[model samples]
Target: MTTTSHSNRDLRDEIRDYWSDRAATFDNDPGHKISAGAELFAWANLFRRHLGAANGRSLLDLASGTGEIALLCKELGFAVTGLDWAEPMLERARSKAPEVTFLQADAERTMLPDASFDVIVTRHLVWTLIDPKAAFAEWRRLLKPGGKILIVDGDFVSRNWLTRMIERFSGSTSHGMVSRHQDIVARVYFNRGARSEAVASLLLEAGFENLRIDNRLSAIHRAQAHLFSWRKSLLRRSEHRYAISASAPMTTKE
Candidate 1:
C-alpha cells in the first residue's frame, strides 16, 4: 500500500483502539449519560426543534458512541441506525438499545447504500475524525434528497476564562485513558482545526447548501451552570473545547 494509505490506516486503528479502550467507562462519565428526566426532555426537545419531527424518518447516528442519540431517536419513533467503528462501543450501544440497528463502520466511509437516510446526526464526533471532508461527502451521499445533517461538536483545545472557572468549581475529573485519547486525537488534522468557522467551510466545500450554525445550544450549556461546570472539568485537559450545532441543506433530485 502507498504511504498515505498506510498512514491513514494507522490513524484509524489508533482512534478505534482509543475508543475501544474507553468503551467500558464511556457511559460512566457524567457528561456522557443522560440519567435525569429533565435532561432527557431537554435533549429530545433540542433534537426536535433542530431536526423537526423524528417519527417515520430514517435517522443515522454516526459515531454513535453508546447509542445515546440513536436510542433517543428510536424513542421518538424514528427509524434509527447507529454506526461506529469501535466494537466495544457498539456493544455498549447494542446492549442499551437492542431495538435500534447498530452497525460497526467508519463514519468517513460507511458501507451502507447511498441516499438511504432522511437525517444524519452526530455529537462530539467531528474532532475525532481524520478526514472530515471525506466524511461530509459520504454523509451527503448517504442522505436522501433534502435530508439534513446535524453535527454537535466543539473545539476543546481553546478554553475561555468562563469555562475555566466553571471547571474549577465543578470538581470534574477525567480518567487517564480519556486524557490520553483526547491528546492523541487533538493532534489530528481536522481535530487540530475544529473551529466552527473551519468546519462550516468544510461543509460548503463538500457540496452542502443552506448551512446554519446554532450556538444557542452552547448558550444552553453555559446556562446550566452546574452541568456545564462538570462537563467542562472532564474536558479541561483538552484544548479547543466548545460545543455548537451545525446543519446544512441537501438538494432534492429532480
Candidate 2:
C-alpha cells in the first residue's frame, strides 16, 4: 500500500480548501481569468484541430477545479474525468456539471489505471508542483500508447501584447509588480519564464514526443491574456525512446 505522511496530507487539504473558496471568484475576477475567454477558446480549438477526432475520446483533466475545461471537453464530445485534490472544488464542479465525472484525487499521484486516457490536460498548475517531472510521468502513465498530454501555462520571458497593454494601462511599475506577485504567490504556482519550459521538458523526459508550445499571440493582439500549450507525443515504442533521465533531475531555474 502507498501512503503520504500526515503533515503532507494536511498541507494538501489546506490548499484544497483555499482553492475552493477562490474558485467561484476566480473566473469573475480579471486577475483570475485573464486569458480565459479568448485564450482558452483558442486552446480548445487547437486541441480540437490536432486531436483529429473528439467523439468518444477519453480525457483526463488534471487539477480540474470546478470543471470549467472538463465541461467544455464534454460539450466537445469527449468523455472526461475531472481530477483534483479538493473536495470543495469537486463539489462545485459536480453541482455545475453532474453529467461529468469529478473525482477528488491528487494530480501528482493518481489511482487510475495506466495508459487509460487519450489526452491529459492541466491549466496553471505548474507552479504548485514540487516535482513537475514526476507529475508529468504520472500523467504519462495514465495515457494510452498513442495518447497526448496538453499543459496550459505561462512563461516569464515570453511576453505577449496584452502584457504590454497591462503595463501601459496600469501606468506605474507598481501595478506590474502587483501582477507579477500574483503569479508567484497564487497558491504556490511557478512564475512565468522557464517554468513553462521546465514543464515541457518534464513531459519530454517522461517518454512524450512531438512536443509543441503555443504562446497565445492572436489573443494577445485582441487585448487578451498570454497563454501557452504543451502537447505530448503519441507513439508506443517511442515512449521508452523518449524517457527523461531518472538519474539526473531536470531543473527549470538551472
**lDDT (CA) for every model shown?**
0.77, 0.61
List RMSD in Å for every model shown.
3.6, 10.5
lDDT score at residue 195, model 2, on the 0-100 scale: 52
Q: Which 10 consecutive residues of model 2 have the lowest summed lDDT?
A: 229-238
TM, every model: 0.84, 0.68
TM-score of 1: 0.84
What C-alpha lDDT, on a 0 to 100 scale, does residue 169 get in candidate 2? 52
Off by over 4 Å in 2: 1-11, 31-43, 156-194, 220-254
Q: What does candidate 2's lDDT look like per residue over 1-254, in tens digits?
A: 13445645655666666676666655663323435567567546756654656878898888887777788788778989999887777887888789998888889888899777877777666656645667777877787776767665554333456555444554344465456445434434343343545666666777777766655334323333222111111111111111111111222553
lDDT for residue 148 in candidate 2, whole number 0-100: 69
Which residue pairs does candidate 2 place in steric collision?
Answer: 127-189, 127-190, 155-193, 156-192, 156-193, 205-244, 209-233
lDDT of 1 by residue, 137-227 (tens): 9888898877888887778655677757666676425667657777777757765447888888888898777677766554334333355
